[model samples]
Target: MDSSDATPAASAPRDPAAPTALRDEADAVLRGLAGETARLREDQWRAVEALVAEHRRVLVVQRTGWGKSAVYFVATALLRARGAGPTVIVSPLLALMRNQIDSAARAGIRARTINSANIDDWDSIQAEVADGLVDVLLVSPERLNNPDFRDTVLPKLAATCGLLVVDEAHCVSDWGHDFRPDYRRLRTLLGDLPGGVPVLATTATANARVTADVAEQLGTGAENTDALVLRGSLDRESLTLGVLQLPDAAHRLAWLDAHLDELPGSGIIYTLTVAAAEEVTAYLRSRGHTVASYSGRTDDAERQAAEADLLANRVKALVATSALGMGFDKGDLGFVVHLGAPQSPIAYYQQIGRAGRAVERADVLLLPGREDEAIWRYFASLGFPPEDQVRRTLDVLASADRPLSTAALEPRVDLRRNRLELMLKVLDVDGAARRVRGGWTATGQPWRYDTERYARVAQARAHEQQAMRDYVATAGCRLEFLRRQLDDEQAVPCGRCDGCAGPRYDAAVDPGALDAARAALGRPGVEVEPRRMWPTGMTEAGVQLKGRIPADEQASTGRALGRLSDIGWGNRLRPVLAADAGDAPVTDDVFNAVVQVLASWGWERRPAGVVTMASRTHGLLIDSLGARLSEVGRLPFLGRIEYAPGAEPAPARSNSAQRLRALAGAFTVPPGLAAAVAAVDGPILLVDDRVDSGWTVTVAARLLRRAGAAEVLPLVLAVEA
Candidate 1:
């Protein structure tokens, strides 16, 4: 949804305008949308002409800020003037839709949006559309699969729509960096469109392969003869790119604090994760710099306010994650700095494209971190599940007597809830499944795993990650490297990048700023809030518990030295807590940090004893820590909870019900441990190396409480985010 253009205009000779006066009127609308002097570029005019006069499907692959929106706005005006229906645009993000609405208003077009944020207005918006009061209607891709929208409103709109625009068309292809399953629904929508209902798909990041896939999908029938593609060079002359590598998270943050004011105008500071965004925002605010955190976790109302503040320059920068990546436009944004490298250069290009759109110059920098590859691996693990898992999901659905909601089906499957939902969506689009009122149902249609394609896609992702690493280490022009990754025909060395113009920013950090960053990051401990309720459909997994957890059986809100995702202590703790990390005695540094957490934990009553969970991977680490804590706090060291013989549970990636089913009776309260628990005076500190789902601690706590312990305080070295 980047509104910038990277490629130069197509060099093809312009066809003589059959209706010259229509062209003149379109230019007037373009001027109103942009400025009095604004006129459509050659390629932009060509797209408008094709959509208005020829009624052909067109794909435009240009860089950000090249006026892609202008093409659609101008085309909609002309088509509406000719008594065509309102344009129906499928946009990807709420921020993008909001920007499009504002842009449409400038052209005297009454544009309205139907998205998750404004459900109450949908009926009113639809009434207006029925009464012919709207010139354009913007929608998110996810809405295409909504039961009510898909069954009720979409058919009518598709029949009468004037122009169909697929914003961020690259997403329609899985080969693209930000591929989305929801976008694939466009294929069905395109096939259902009334003939001659001009379609326009626009994107700035699609490589050649993605463009081809999207263009093929845009075609009306099995044969792809009706679509026209206009691709351009992706060069952005206004951006000055650079890379800065530092030792660790603290130095990267310290550098930002030291030089944030030196950055020109209001801009963005990008972080790779939500935790890091919050961390950087807090550090910057504590240092007296104006900034706000923006991530998917931020509420919708807050996101809107943050976007407004950024546009008004109320804050110097919005420390953000990829949530702010696509389709939030500020014409004069002046800088973008990445605290950690993204896995793909195409994604990086799209994020940085937000800067330098209408400005004379913009600064773009990447402060690559050592932990970036680990973060990449974590995300990669969430991609398409194995074929056997997919088969399992299908088999469950095929055998169900009624549609099963995701919640109801979760216990029966081994996949995580989110991944399962995504797989179902893809299957729905592929005709092997359907999403109805109740939930998902099998279509009994033929389905193939397409293992070759999936494997190729995985390979592509690995290549992209390597390209990102090369971009950070390259001595050649950074702009050229990114362009080549996108297969931009006009990829060339930009004389303005650090590689071409030499380093533009210094790596030195002020000593005071470094100290403050270190202090903020070195600060330890995150509260591990106990689960208060059981997951639905526990009965399906053979676990009888339901509703609210009994208060007496619940573990008290506990603490961990740090989250594995935290940028500060996270970097230090990951090595010790990693699955392959060898078991060893407690390290002095980690032991002292746990002591600090315990010292600050203002409990109502002190813990009288310590107990360890029997760890399969970290038994030594857990035992050593438990003994050391007991010795230090002068609390008695109780025996460890032992796993029931032959009860090795599977890894806890399954839903709460599935995980609990595997662990319900998996632990035994040995006589010695039970006796020790009865002898305890107060709370017992439950020790473990790490906590993922927290069910392990919950089960063990229940066993201890049943054995006569009054309270359990769960403590861990690390917590998975």
Candidate 2:
């Protein structure tokens, strides 16, 4: 049952004493039959020949669509002729595994996947491997991690394994562009195999750090490994990189609409959030674009359907989060648009690589905005654990001999499970600890309390954050920076980037615009009163301006003023003179008149508050004023507005009936509420705050009109209901 006994027959060789030119012609004949000689570049062909001649593992780090896979596919044919055992390729995606298997089958080589869906076929697959019938076995990391499968099957496969190839091998390194925790265990798994198999790792994106990490992870020391770190030329002469600065969501949507028709063939629009993906997909679909959407929430069936539609050209474009692109091999994609900036250069590379798969010219569009940087910063902050927390976590783990589940460790570390999980993953990557079974354990050495471990983690996290910050702030060639980050030595200036294109702010600000805004605010109209001016939620700086009027105006005048502010007519007003100005013609008489009307209507102004309104009606009036203020805030001198001091009006509260009615009007209630209203369910009335309108009382009455209400009387400090 020995592996060599069952191995395939070695092909006949040309004479060893033959001239080099004769041997080259013989090699060309074998390559021609495989149809690889015509497809491969001269350099690529030379690299492959050298690999076969030396029988040494080769690492090819070419750009996407450079025929990297052909190098290995052709090598597989040649190596088989030389009596090499079956090639065992480890990939992270099932789709890629299947694709590779299909390609091998086209080349008349036997290939199969040993993955979750085909666990039942493992026994037969193992037999084939043992009998030396399987030429290539493509398995995912999950398959290797399967204890039962690994214990029984891998040992047999290892005995006969040759040419161990790891596709997207950057996943193995923590510092790699894309790091997977499962990939961290690959080195151990490979080391455990029989006969110390030769390893070849390939990826389109890997920097110097990633290369070094890959070398170490594959047990090929940096200096000793036969690594061909090819820096592909960044002169994608046919492709154009465009960066669009979107000032707001509306602008972004408009841009998408304008460009929807221009996009031909299959394309992808990447968004930062699932909701954004879904929303954008819906919007695009409404505008007559055949679109499919993918996000983490998309089920397996839905994902498959969308992916199929994309591949079949049923959908011309797909709106998705970053989760959709890995392992996707769509050859005809013409564009990749980022609805927002990608998280990192690594991510951008992978996403953009999805396009131009067939070597056709393509384009990548980046919609850069402040929100993009914010999202990356938020994620990076969440990824890093504080040094104190890290130290405590390590101490707790070191104290435990057996693996402790996250729930059990939570109490010990005084952190939530989600937070602890992230911290643990980071610690594992930094070599501080290892995830074992259901929990984590300290590695060989306890993390030194005073050492650079904590500093290194912090520095790494900071570096990632700074990378994102630089992307947002840099006024340089975006493509060049991206290529440089990926170690592409041939990178040249991309004339299409924002910096190369032109200055972003070419339009001059018009003073007339400010004057128009001021006139719009100051004209006879309602005014919105300001609330707390600082820390308004999620709005741009210029949205708060509006017209303001003296508080002493007639109630009808005040209402009219508030209405004007609500409709955005009075957004540019400024209070140049105080209401009590001695030189003013209207003087305190106008101010007093408005004050009296407000007080009578239960709307009062407090000395210290922005504008204290006693009721929701008055609050609504203030909201209107704030909107106008936002416009006026843009003016240099007119932006400064001071609130006049005044006495607080008595609080006019309402009964439950009034409060309930208001809530009902504001929100859509279920049919259960209608039935409860008819039944007059006398739910205990609880009032923590004052209700000014009688809407709550009216609503309760409507409910209790059918149901019995012992008493609908108000029970607050003051009642208007």
The candidate that wins on lDDT is 1
On TM-score, the leading prediction is: 1
Model 1: lowest-lDDT 10 consecutive positions: 1-10
Q: Candidate 1 — which residues are off by over 4 angstroms?
A: 1-15, 222-224
Root mean square deviation (Cα) for candidate 1:
2.5
Error of 2 at 421 (Å): 4.9
Tell how far residue 693 is off in model 2, in angstroms.
36
TM-scores of all predicted structures: 0.97, 0.61
- Whole-model Cα lDDT of every candidate shown, in order: 0.89, 0.53
Worst 10 residues of 2 by lDDT: 564-573
